[model samples]
Target chain A: MAIVAKSLKYTKHGEPQDVLELVEQKIESPQAKQVLVKILAAPINPADINTIQGKYPVKPKFPAVAGNEFVGEVICVGDEVKSVETGQHVVPLATGLGTWTTHAVYQEDQVMAVSKNVGLAEAATITVNPCTAYRMLKDFVQLKPGDTVIQNGANSAVGQAVHQLCRAWGINSIGIVRNRPEIEELKQMLQCLGATAILTEEEIRTSDIFKTGKLKRPKLAFNCVGGKSATEVSRHLDNSGVMVTYGGMSREPVTVATGPLIFKDIAFRGFWMTRWSKENYDTPERKQMFKDLCDLMEQGKFVAPVHEMVPLDKFKDAAAAALSFKGFTGKKFILDMSK
Target chain B: MAIVAKSLKYTKHGEPQDVLELVEQKIESPQAKQVLVKILAAPINPADINTIQGKYPVKPKFPAVAGNEFVGEVICVGDEVKSVETGQHVVPLATGLGTWTTHAVYQEDQVMAVSKNVGLAEAATITVNPCTAYRMLKDFVQLKPGDTVIQNGANSAVGQAVHQLCRAWGINSIGIVRNRPEIEELKQMLQCLGATAILTEEEIRTSDIFKTGKLKRPKLAFNCVGGKSATEVSRHLDNSGVMVTYGGMSREPVTVATGPLIFKDIAFRGFWMTRWSKENYDTPERKQMFKDLCDLMEQGKFVAPVHEMVPLDKFKDAAAAALSFKGFTGKKFILDMSK
Candidate 1:
């Protein structure tokens, strides 16, 4: 069967709202090793916006699909496909699977059969930020129950995931965010999401949580906002700690004093979700991660990020909203392709 | 026999020369596990100066001896001392054993009997800087014989050792130093010691050594001078490369861009010779490191750094010269305590 599917496509990199256009692509039957899927929801993540702006590492050729993550339903499978059958909800096992479309055909291995237990927004963001938080916490340092993980940009999508996961896993978390007029409300929101403690960037500079016996110094630190914020988060890490950088929202560099690096034996490293996904796809570890995350959702211990759902046709407004943190809304934009 | 010895002593933290005083102390005979040694030469290392100013991590109480490294001749050993015999030469096995005195009694195990094949300067300086260069090269990355290492502060004492050791190990080394009026001369000198390529900091900012096939982008980079210099050295590291910082000569924090750190998988870490020595003090690894370094010295593959030997009474002048770059002289000041 042939279907006319509308996809948000970009011929070249530019502003997401300026360069993206709705184009109709011919969707054919799944090849022998492929499966056809109906995309349900796709989020305009910062990485996706960066991809449209040509600022990300993974760039597809011209006239490429405009999104990298989404949740979809498997419509049908080809003769050689055994991974999923009809009516199964699925997502890409790795990144670079453009999801800003009504329908598409993908090779069987590139798609993961995710459980139907998660909500549309949670499942759509399963592969990027959540996986980043998961892998960084698991891979870099071993955190026992009650151990702490400190992070900056606690209001980011990844940070929200980190908070929930840390809570579900019985870990303590200290969050660093910028001081704002509505910070107390934001703090309350994140605390509900599982943040053990929250402090503004300025407060972290003078916070003696470690010294005053309020919280154990973090053995692991995650950084998204760079510059002075990154350094301040690093300063509170425990002896022989590890600080991992996953993003630079502040657009500044990570600066580290020689004292902590030398005297405390602190190690500085970077984690790229795209790279980690590409390397670990199809591995048992990746499978276990999805299973665990889905189990968390099934148990109602995990919830999706705060988001505003938009129809596919209103992608321009979604893109603009994602670009401007629009009045510090703390809300992600999920394009509801089902409409 | 009782001995009257002149020792450089400091009572409190201040400038090295301003606080140091030559004091006469009567030394007693060796205790059961002690060896009495007559000091030969002690060079004023930067760490020693920092210690004198109470800026280093390992600071002694007030009225402490003034130096950290020296070579000495064993004058006598007690009945239980099996490490060294009378007339044997030795150096401290680790830091914090002050070495400025003409004669002192040391616990037998605190010193290592070194071969007389090395010169006074080389033997006196065996425990710190050279060991720093040696351990950093061997520990971080496995560079096979033909692999390369790139480093800044190439005219530093550790850099000189790194050049010679790389030569002996058949590894290529690229040096980055400041561009000066005598740049060519410094380049020639380092090239003689075995730098595969030499570049000024400014040239490295735009150099294409890696791009032009002049040298392979190093898997290992050594950084002593931090800030932009550290950033430039880090920029040339190969995929998943590691940069180790041992000294912050510029007194600036190490700044790293999020791009290389995330995309290229570069890692930033610090190396402290004091920490390494303290951890590996009684281990076979320490013994093997010293043996390998001395073996290189014995084969004439390593030479003493450029130095000026001053009599013990001229200690203040040596301290002054050590404090000042004074026309950027590379010659280290060694106090000839034997006189």
Candidate 2:
């Protein structure tokens, strides 16, 4: 019998809504050591949009499937498959798996079985954003308990993940966000999630950390929104501290005054989860990072961000929502393949 | 007999020419563990000017002497002094001992004996600029023989030192300089010192490394000129490479596009020799670096930059020339105390 798989495919690089299309394919049974996975839920990440728009460094070949990560159930396995069995939930062992689909065929080692205790949305979205946060925090500065980290984009998925991780590690965090009408609500939300202090962009500019003596100089800075926000956060970093830039939401360059680099010995570095994962593929450290996140999720210490689930056929709507700049500012759009 | 010393002194921070004054002081005999040294030659470095203007991270106390480094001869030794005999040449073991005066009293350990084979000019300036170049090249990047490094301000003192060191290590260096009337002459001068390829600022912006491919992507970049020059140099760095900023001649911030940080994993850091020396004081590695540089100088491979020797009494002229924006662009002004 022939197995039919439905997927979102893009033949060329352009705007996601302009290039992405729904397509169907016929698949034969898995070959030796291969497993057939029926995708359950996949999130539409900003990186996924950038990939479709050809702005990201890693791109798919032409006439290729579109999504990078997902949670799926093992439907069938080849005769030689042994690590995972049917009905087990798993995620792509690495990135670039074209996860926005109804089903996929992969080699036995291409997926890792995850605990079913976490919800499908959390499991599906765990590989990228959370991993990025985990690596940047753990790899850049060695933070001791009571040490502080300051970051912008505090409400972002990775930013919230940093807050939760900091709380669990007994570290303090100062979160900065843009000025908005519901600033208090946003601050309260982040505080509930364990941010020690939250401030709007304006407050940080005229901050008197030396005068009012609110917080110590942050030992580390996480910059996802480059521009004035990134600069202000960097200005507060302790001597010889490092600011890791993983994303630039402001569409502006990372601007640093020459004084800090020469006098205080501050360093600026970039961290791309894709590059880090590929360079350190299948290391025990990476495995431990995932296991830690999974355990946190299972223990109800970390919850997935607010998200809207849409059926695969409604991809255009999902793509438009992911591309929208206004509503659902902090929510992810997940493709509900089961629908 | 009273040893009367005439020295440039600054009572407060201001323009070098406006605030610096010639003051006469009576020098005392060498105390226990102390040595009296008569200054021979001292280079007026940009850092010395910055220190006078109070713009540098290190500032002097009021009523301070005006120079940081110099070469001198041991005139007498105290009872406990053992490192060097009378007439032995030496340089300061640390910064902040004013060197522009005719004589100084230092603890025996405060000076290191050096070979008279190298001229006083090279010995006077060795402790700062050459040490900076060596530390930056060694500390930031793990450069191997045959690897390539790029830098701007190719005719400056440190730049020439970098070229000589790279030649010694069998590494290639692409030098970037401004467009000048004597551009070809400057290029030839640097080439004689061992630059692989020299280009003007415009040439670097339009370099055909992407098309004609004359040079490999540099594994390291030494940026003293910040702003666009630093960014352009960083653009050509190999993936995961670093750009070490020691100075910012343009007086602008180091601006970097976000693309390289996330896509190529390029890093930006600053190097202050004072900070490094203070932090790694009395380490064997630092001693070895100094020994290696001294050997290179004695071998006649590393020569000091072109300079105009001015008498110590002509302090105003030397300070004025050091502050001048034109004429003698790459040449240092040395105080000739013996004259």
Candidate 3:
């Protein structure tokens, strides 16, 4: 049987508001080794908007459904389906799967089963930001309990996740953010979320945190805002530390001094969740990472970033909020498809 | 007994030419586990000049004998010395030992014995540039025969060494040089030394070498000139490749785009010969590297960069030439201290 479901679709690449349209998408019954999924919630990530604007590196087919991440319920399974059963929660193993539709039929292997013990919004957002934060911390320099991590865009979803995970894992983190009018409020929020310290990017370069012995110097730095901000974060890195750049919200390139490179031997690297997902799709490490993250979430040691939940009919409002976001600020917008 | 020998000395840090002067100093006879060495030849490397200017990180003591690298002949050994015999050639095992002096007493372990079959200039320069090039090639990536390497500052001594070694190892190389009036000459020289292709920094960004299938894209990029030059060299790297920054001749910080770091998973790393020496001083890797480099030199597979060999008395002119060196151009200036 074929089922009609509401979906956010775009036939041309342009501004999300200009091109994205809500249309009825007819989804067919699951084929052998396929499962029909009912998307429970999906977040309007920046990549989603970038995909619509045609400014992103990934070029999906035209007349594409929008969204790259979602939490869905397996509603039906084909005769030969064995990996997932009806009523189980799942997350897409691969990225760029057109996740905005109310329902989708995926190959049994394309989805990874997830526990329903976590919050709907938290589950919806796990596959990208948290995974990125998790991998950056684990795969780069090994972080011991006493070691510190410094990162710009500390209020970003990934940064928030890093703080929570660091706390859960007994590691210390100093979050660097731009000085803003609500700086104190932001600082308090991050502190509550387990950040050991929060400072402006300027303060990080000449902070008393390490000088005053309040915190150890960082061995890993996360850079999302490039330019001087990236340099400042890297400047605070300990000898032989690594600076991993995952985003360039400032649209500036990363700049590094020649002195440290030659003398201290630091490294600059990058991470993209889409690429990581594809590369590690069948790896045991990926399964263990998700398992660990979910365990943290179930224990309430990890929670979704501060976000606003909207019913699917108000996706335009969510897209507007995403576009209106200024420099890693604002709450994430997640659509509740069941509404 | 004591030996009186002349050396280039600096009482304080300032302009290399202003602060440096040739002075005759007395060297005491070898103590227990020490050897009296007569300096043979040493090059006025950029690091040596920077140290004199106080711009470099490593600070030698005041009234310091200038020069960090040299090839010397062991003249006498104390009773307990076992590392080297009298008349054996040796190079400093550590940087900042002040190698410009004609005669000095060194601890037996402070120097590593070297074969004297290679040319004086080649051996003199080997402890730094060739070692740097060799390590950058072998340490970072596991490049094999037919693998390609891309590097900026192709005319640099290290760049020249990379070209020769790549050829000897059956690896192809593309050397990126700035567009100068002598561009064709520079290109021809690099090619003659076994560079598969020589492209200008601008040409590298859009070169047909990889597009036309003339050469494989480099898995490793050697960056000496930073800023836009570093970015251009990094642009042509293959997926998961690394750009190792050794020198910043342009005095501009290395600038890298976020796209490659994420999409291609490329890396930016730094290599400092001094740091590497300290870490690997007593390791078999260090011994093997020097042996490998020396073997190549003796086999006529590797030769020193074009250089002007100045006598010890003409130290001031060599200092001037080193200071006047413009953006990776000009020949190396080596001092034949035995003169």
Candidate 4:
């Protein structure tokens, strides 16, 4: 039987609302080594919007479907499919799979089986931000249990993931965020998620934490927001420490003083999940990382950030909401394709 | 007979001329495992000035003698001293030994015998600048023959050493300097030392070397002049390349765009010769580095930078010249203590 799939696609690069349109395609039954998946849920990431505008490094081909990550269920499998079975939940094994469709056909190697024990929101958005957080922490400096880590964008999805992972590893974290009216509320929320301490960008420079030696200087700093915040975060790192940049929300360059670079032996590096996945797709280490994240989610030790769900037809609204900096700036918007 | 030594001493941090004084002290004969040496030559490095002004990361104790590196001739050795014979040349094995003197006593373990085949000037200025250049090239990047390196301040002492060493290693270098009145003369000098190309800072951004692919994007970049030069140099690095900072002549911070850090995966790190020597004092790697440099110098492949020799009594002039930018900016000044 043939499956009629509805997808959000763009024929040209422009604003999401102006260029994205709904299109129907006939997806045949699973080919020799293919599987048919019914996408259940997906999230609208900032990178997705950038991709639509052709501003991101990873550009899609013209007439391309939108969305990078999602959680789906296997409806049918070809005779050669041994890694996955019908009625199994899975996620894209790599990036640029275009997961915004109601139904799609994929080669068996393109999807990996995931445990259904994870919440829909957590499983749908798990492949990108959480994986990025995991790699940044694991691949950079080797932190001992008592070692301290500092990061900005404390309210970001990746930052929250870092907090939980650090907690699980018995490492201390000092999270930094911008000052807002609900700063107190955000601080309390982060503290509950296992942040050892939380401060705004302004407080970071004046705080006695670095002076009193009560908390050792951070050995690793995660920078998602650049500009002055990146500089402030990097200045507090211990000697020979490294600051890894995975995202740039401020659109500013990373600045470091000569004193730190030469005297303190500080280092700066970058991490990209898309590149990592593409380069290491066939490695056992990548599989192990996914297994570890799923295990934590199933144990309730890690939870997805605050999210609002919208049905597939309301994707334009979800995209607009994700792009807005108005009320609830920290929450993610997920499309419930099952609806 | 008691040996009377005249040494420059500083009791506090201030201008080198104001705080420095020639003090006379009695130096006794070599005791048990000790060797007495007559200081020969020491170069006036910018770091020495910084050290006197208490602006460097390494601070000396009060009432400290002035120089950090020198070449000296062994005059007398105790019964237990075996590392060097009388009339042999040696340099300090550790920093802060105060080399600006007529005579001083050192333990057998405190000095390393170097080849007299090297000239007095080359052997005297060998420990810091040459070692820094070597370490910056070897430690930060795994460069092979034909690979390209880019650096600013290509007329500085360290920069000259880099040009010679890259020549020895068969690596290509793009040397950047400021537009001086004698720019052509300076460029010819660097090219004779094996620099593949030399340009002013203003020409770096407009250069087509990176885009033409005739010269591959540099795998390693040496940044001595921070600020705009550092930014321009780093922007041209190959993917996953590193820029190692050793000095900041411009007294400005190193700034890099967020795009390169995340999208191109360029890295920035620092290299301090003092730190590396202290941390790896006992390693075979340190010994091997010295051997490599000495071998190159002995082969006439590496030569000390152009220098003007001033007797100890003319130290005031040398200090002033070393601190000036108008005349002999690229030349080093050495104190001929023996004369």
- Candidate closest to the true structure, highest TM-score: 4
Each candidate's number of clashing pairs is: 0, 0, 0, 0
Interface RMSD of each: 0.7, 0.7, 0.9, 0.8
Alpha carbon lDDT of each predicted model? 0.87, 0.87, 0.87, 0.88
- Kindly list the per-residue Cα lDDT of model 2 for residues A122-160, writing each as its tens digit: 899898888988898899888898888998988888888
Q: Which regions of candidate 1 fall more than 4 Å away from where they truly are?
A: A326-329, B326-329
List clashing residue pairs in candidate 2.
none
Note the B-chain TM-score for every model.
Answer: 0.97, 0.96, 0.97, 0.97
Q: Which candidate number has the best lDDT? A: 4
Q: List the lowest-lDDT window of 10 residues for candidate 1 chain B.
A: B323-332
Q: lDDT tens string, model 1, A1-339?
A: 778889999998999889999999899898798999999998888878888899877787887988888899999789999979889999887577778999989999988887887888889878877888899999989899889999999988889999999999899988999899999999999999999999999888987877987667799999988899998889888887999998888889999898888888898999998888878877899889999988887788888788999999999988998888831235889999876
Q: Which residue pairs in candidate 4 have backbone atoms (N, alpha carbon, C) closer than 3 angstroms, thus clashing?
A: none
Task: Report the lDDT tens digits of candidate 3 across residue range B185-265.
Answer: 888988898888888877877767888776788899999889888888888899999999999888898888888887788
Provide per-model DockQ scores.
0.77, 0.84, 0.81, 0.86
- Which scores greater on TM-score, model 1 or model 4? 4
Query: How well is each residue in A318-339 modelled by candidate 4, as lDDT tens digits?
Result: 8877777431246888889876
Model 3: how far is B26 from its true place, Å? Answer: 3.3
* Residue B257, model 4, lDDT: 82
In terms of lDDT, model 2 sits at 0.87
State the lDDT of candidate 1 residue by residue for B221-245, as single tens digits.
9988899999989988999899998
The alpha-carbon lDDT assigned to residue B18 of candidate 1 equals 89
Q: Which ten residues in a row have the lowest lDDT in candidate 2 chain B?
A: B321-330
